[model samples]
Target: MTRKIWVFDTTLRDGEQVPGAKLNLYEKLEVAQQLKKLQVDIIEAGFPASSAGDFDAVKEIATKVGNTSDLMITALARAVKSDIDAVYNSVKYAEKPLIHIVLGTSDIHVEKKFGKSKSQILNIGVEAVKYAKTLLPDVQYSTEDASRSEFEYLWATIEAVVKAGATMINVPDTVGFAEPEEFGERIFKLNDRLKNLNDKVLLSVHCHNDLGMATANTLAAIKNGADKVECTINGIGERAGNAALEEVVMAINTRSSIYNVHTNIKTKEIMNTSRLVSSLMGLDVQVNKAITGENAFAHSSGIHQDGLLKSRDAYEIISPVEVGLDDMELVLTARSGRHAVKNALEKLGFHQITNSQFEGIFEAFLELADAKKEVYNHDLYVIVENYYAKQDVHNENMTYYSDHFYELMDLQVISNINFPSASVKMKRGDQILKSSAVGSGPIDALYSAITEISELDIKLIEYNISSVSRGKEALGKVKIQVEYRGEKYIAKATETDIMKASALAYINAINSIVVDQLLPVE
Candidate 1:
């Protein structure tokens, strides 16, 4: 029989530790609702003792979501009475409330950070669990940086915590410094040596992504003996971040033959949850990121597209719809052949085309592909629509070109050793708006000026620039992703001047947002 793997999501606590990724009370509540929808076994709402705001958030989540969701609500605390009491106060209203207490057990942490000996650390952990058990029935104890600690001492600490009434013990790869084999061996050895305690209590693993091996290390632990995984949404956390909850859950779901384990995650909610987290945090998921990225299910290669068109399983291991995505995307590129082009055109509702028209469109597609990295559905629609529009004009029919809702008129930037300033002129319909602002850098000033002129409260989630062709005067392509009113919009532009490309890209993204708002819902 396969083992049941519990998912404990710490997005509100550990994930929030990422710099500049703080969530306010309403945002916290929003994320907690999504986590509930995701069906995680436990939600580590926040560190209540950290601040009054966190305490209120935790309390609110516990009362609003946790009590009704039938899932456990937990909060982080150090191995201290005050911290444990704070957590207790925050989560006490939940139907199932848990107190999670952590202590540093590694030699470096013990001697340097805590200035305590091994025995002292062990005593504190045991006492903290015992005290926590008095307040909550479910108590979880974590030994910080357990991967680097002495094995024997770590086993002794686990035994002590379990004996002191800790129902769960989390052995974390705190610094993400352990390899999979070694981490697996550590868990296997602990379970082998402490059979009585291991059989009675749950063994959990929390891994960081500093080494980009958190998911691998976590899989090793689960394969060995771990019963729970401590993770965060989109892997957002301190340093490089924690192991991603979606990745781990999907890994187990997709590779059940190997791991022989399953999770309680509602797989269909994965993408929605990821988007919600990314939007609220003002972070952009990388295009090539696994599982929930923009390009995760996008096929661009000719051979891959051919195989996918024949059968989805020929190229995709998991269906996009399984993760809440609408469908797979066959992105048209220079690498795409005639069949791929026809397929894309059909998807864009351009099914009928003469051979000559097909040749012309394919030629134009090649030119566009040479200029851009990838051609989107919108670009293909524009190409086909323009072709028919030209035909209509040749037949002496009237045609109207759609005007841009927002257009950039002029931009002037001044940068020096002191303060940098920028001025921008924008045209919206019959109105010409002008604004100027000062910033720490030229791009910042320019963006500030644009925002001031447009009056759109947007957050720049991602900015990337690359050369379309290699030369001294290479055509620079700028891609910008921005978030407005909880929605993400991406736009790209190319120009000889990098700054010009950047300004155009920013304004184009703003225009795309406006267009989306103006579009009629189907």
Candidate 2:
């Protein structure tokens, strides 16, 4: 029988520790829902004792998702009674609540970070586990930097925690300092020496990517004896990152013949889950990342292309469809032919194209091919989607006056060595409004001008800009969140010019505010 490996997702706890990668309450809820869809066995929500906001997030997740799903919901806590209490309070409503208590056990961490000796660390770990068991039956204990701890001491600590009622023992390569072979050996030795280890408790591994070997080390541990893998989506976490949930799951799936292990993850949801995490976290996966990157299924070279065309097994190990890629992307470049473009469009859900539409799209594709080194699926989708959106707007007569809307008329800005000033004209309903204001920067001045004309007291909370396509003249997309009368609204707009995109995005947000007011109160 194949061993069942549990996936413990710490995207909300460890993954959020990445500097400046904070997710608000709603964002956390969204990620939790996706994690459920990913079918992770455990979701470590957050450290409830850290902040009221974190506490609320954990509580809400525990109530909303935990009660509804079969998966266990957990929260992290230091090996302190107060922290354990907070964890219990936050997740008491969960269907299967777990409190993960950790302590520093390595010589450096115990001596320098906590000024506690090995005996003190063991005592703390035992006390915390015993206390946590009083509140929740399922308790997990981790000796921080377990990879660097002395072997005998680590074993003693584990033995103590298990005796204190810890159901799971996590060995973290806290600083990502372990090689694959060494890490595997450690887990194997622990499994060998620990009395009734597998029967009494599950052995888990949480490896970081500081040495860029998180996935390798994790696989090695699983090969040896680990029954659980703690990881974050897209490998996001402190410093380098934790093992990526996607990489590990896909690794086990692709090489199941060798590993002979299976996880509970819904493999088809992998790509969508990866995208959601990246979007909410504002982090981009590297192009060459193992499974969920942009170029993961992209074919470039002619020889490789020929082999792929003949048989995917010639060069590809994992089918794109297996990881929810749906279709493999053979990039459309100058070297690509009509067959490739036709196949690409068909895969993009643009089948049944008329001769005229095909001709137009092909012409546009040729132009894009000349301009860009490679035309991506997104570029193709944008081209096709924009064409349809424009056609719909024309056919439906979807003018701004049809609703509570604002349209940008004209914008002018002057930015010299001094403070920047902007002038703007906008059409609101049947009225034309104009205003001028000076600000610290051109974008700031433009927003100030718009605010003055609209006369709505709104605070800009967040603004992000990115290019929709590749090139000097690529379309710029702007997304902004604004607070109006204690309510928040998000709006997005795209334009060839970035400044225009910014202005349009702000106006769109203001329009949403107006529309919200007209809606009947629930």
Candidate 3:
């Protein structure tokens, strides 16, 4: 039997630290459920010591999602007893709770960040592990900026923490400073050096993408002796971001023979999980990012197209199907009936549809099919989600997909040689708000109209337009980035009308700023 790799996902904790990537309590729960479905071995829920809101959110996830799954849920804390206490209080409800502790041991970190001596820093790290062990058997210890720490000091710190009862030791390329081979050899030597302590101590790696080698470095560490990998969905984190979970998992699975390791990740949930994170977090994954990027499986060049048509292996190593993407050229037109929609949903792996649910899905599908010449798989997912939002079903889908604080009730835009203008009708709870504005273009006009209604100080940062698939009938997608009070927010929408998509996308982003931004902590 091949050795198992523990997939530790920190999308909620570290990934949520990104400015304006906040997920409300409900959104966090939704993400936790999805991660559970993704079959990650561990979930770092949050840094409970940071804020009262974080503490409550972590406790809620442990009590709700953690109780149902075999997932080992945890929260991060500093070496201080207060921080550890907050973590313990939040994670105590989990069946398998873990406490993650971190203290920088590098000369620069010790001197500059902590203003402490090397011995003092080492003592802090060890004490944290010791105290965390008393609370939970599953304790993880990370050396902040481990790549930059002195090798001897780092090794000594690791041995001390392991002796202090840390079941997992994470060596983080905190600033993404380590090159792949160097990082790999570091893990190898450390694992070799710590062998005498006990075989139960698991070595782990957490590599950031500052140098664009996070995935490479993580894979290299796994190739050496690391037993666990820490990552986030869509590679979202501070600065350049952390290693992407999809990329690391696919790399290991594709070259399993090279590493001779296996992970419990449900390979099929990769695409959906990536999309869910991207949508809720409002951070679009770069189109060219590896694994879950929009262009990961796309072939555009003539030579590449010919090669792909001749033999899929010529240019592709991972099929779209393996990652929950349906590449089948299936299309549904306005004439397609209920039976056809049902079959299409089944083909897309969406099963267990009740009669009422099918009725709703089919109705939404017909509406979309009428707007476009043909509706594809991506369109179906959106249709079903939109239907979920409209329904009063009181189910998970309804709660997860419902409007934030604003919903687009109606929109109209006109762009002519004279000028561009737009009108918007939206709802905020029981209020019907209508506004209109003129801009240089249709999207600008829509955003201007929305800004007028929102009456919020927002600066437009970036606007991107994409398609669900190729061809003229493809669904138009618009993703907009805006800044309010120095925090960045992004939102996207898809529709047959680019103008409508633009309107809804901007409205969605503003809604996030209103709802998530104004949410009272605690």
lDDT of each: 0.86, 0.85, 0.83
- lDDT: which candidate is best? 1
Q: Which stretches of candidate 1 lie over 4 Å from their true place?
A: 372-522
Clashing pairs in 3: none
lDDT tens digits by residue: candidate 2, 286-393? 768989987889876656666677787988988889887767767667677665677767754556666776767777777887775566554565555455565552
The better-scoring model by TM-score among 2 and 3 is 2
**Model 1 weakest 10-residue run by lDDT:** 395-404
Best by TM-score: 1
Query: How many clashing residue pairs appear in each of the predictions shown?
Result: 0, 0, 0
Which model, 1 or 3, shows the larger TM-score? 1
What TM-score, computed on C-alpha atoms, does each candidate reach? Answer: 0.79, 0.72, 0.68
> Could you give candidate 1's per-residue lDDT for residues 447-491 as a string of tens digits?
999998778999998777767698888998888889999988778
> What is the model-wide C-alpha lDDT for candidate 1?
0.86
Model 2 local distance difference test score:
0.85
